[model samples]
Target: MKGRSRSTGLLLVISGASFWGVGGTVAQKLFQEFGISVDWLVTARLLTAGVLLLAVQFLLKDRSQVIGVWKNKRAAIMLLIFGLAGMLAVQYTYMASIHHGNAAVATLLQYLAPAMIIIYLVLRKQSVFSRQDFVTVSLALAGCFFLLTNGSVSQLSVPAPAIVWGVLSGVALAFYTLYAIPLLKEYDSLVVVGWAMVIGGSALSFIHPPWQMDFGSLSAEAYLYLVFVIIFGTMLAFWFYIESLQTLSPTETSLLSSLEPLAAVFTTVIWLNEPFGIYQWAGTACIFGMILLLALNKKKPAKSNDSVENEEPLRVS
Candidate 1:
């Protein structure tokens, strides 16, 4: 039973990561081949996925968490900030990265969030600097530089705007990772993430309403891709990752999720025929190396910050 549980956890993590990677790829396809607007897609994804997840939580999990969260004005306010600023910003920046570049680059770029989180923790006095942290930061910086510049300052291999958006996505993801911990401990993952989606989506709706987009103009295939993004990418991916937490430690879960970017790179290069040079591959290796570096660090007694009650923010990627 122990072996079976471990295997199940591994499978769940792999599936979750793969779905996220493929979902990003499909999103890129919609943007590049189908002319789908990022605004419409992001809005619809957040709103629809949020409603679906909350409905599931209400039916299958804790119903009270649905309303209980809002009963506390303080917790509700933090949730609101997480939803509107963290969720909305991360989603928008991530999609924008894929829009400017390929899924591979965007996903790898977002992996920098781990390093950013480390720095934030240190600055906030939540965590102290370690040798491992120094190594992680070095690899991340070198990897990003090589991936973007390819060892020369003469020209950029990737678009400048894509890099900006990708870095922003990492920053936003760091915020999501750190801020959602308290909420996740207090409420179901679905409650926190679901409401966050609704809040963020609603805010963006005012900027670019989902109804404003020409849905009819898109091909049936495009609609299918969009559905995949909402269901498989956003909802199911998160579900599998959360389920894995039942058996795996947070560190193990995070290390395994490095597969997300690897899957993205493979799909983007092979399926999408995107150009990824040797420098990019090296950069990918560095990012993955950092993941391993963190995961292999000596484990300590779980704390609110390290514990995964229902979800790890890594799932959000």
Candidate 2:
């Protein structure tokens, strides 16, 4: 049963990431046809996800766990921060990166989250890096900087604000990944997602009022895609992401999910007819090699060090 459950969990995680990987394609399509603002889309996604998640929790008799987090001030505060910093801030900045730069650039830059995770752990003194860790981090960093560079050093001209937003998104994603582990132990995945969505949605709704939405302007296709983003992209993906957190450590999950950018790049090339460049593929290969290195060299703590606790929260979206 344990093995089956784990296999099931791993499957869920991969499927969820895959769903999210396709979301950008769907989103790009919607942007072309419906003229929807990314801010509004983000707001709508958070609200719709929160409602559906809460509905599922109640229907599944998961309210006790939901109420438990509500009663704990520390957990409640953490959820709020997770909603703000992880969900709202990260998505907002990422969308801004896409808005200011090309989605390809934005997508490639965000996967730097894994390297940021390693840096954060090192800063916390929780990381004991082997040569493998150094190699992975070095390769990931080189790939990121190479993608950020435009033509030549003298010709580097990407918008400073876009670069700032992309880097901030990566940092937020890294922190979110690290924090997700311990939170997984404290609450059911859905419960945590529900609360985070509620807070995140509520926060966004305040920034972009619902009254501003033009309901009558939407077409059937737009609504369909919108529903897809909310249901599959937000709700379903978040559940599996959180479930993956249950079994995979932060570094493992972050490294694996780095494939999200690779998926995005390929999907863009095929769906959007975006021209692929050799430099981009080379950078992607380097990132992939880094991820493989991390996966293969994952170290187990010493046999005598069984008491080392995993106190970090599990972050999935």
Error of 1 at 153 (Å): 2.5
Best by lDDT: 1
As a TM-score, model 1 comes out at 0.93
Instruction: Give Cα-based local distance difference scores for all models.
Output: 0.85, 0.69
Q: What tens-digit string does per-residue lDDT give for candidate 2 at 171-263?
A: 877766656555667777677767777787788887787558888989898888888777886788766776676676655565556555666
Per-candidate TM-scores read 0.93, 0.83
Model 2 Cα shift for residue 31 (angstroms): 3.4
What residue runs in model 1 are displaced by over 4 Å at the alpha carbon?
1-5, 298-314
Candidate 1: C-alpha RMSD to true structure equals 2.4
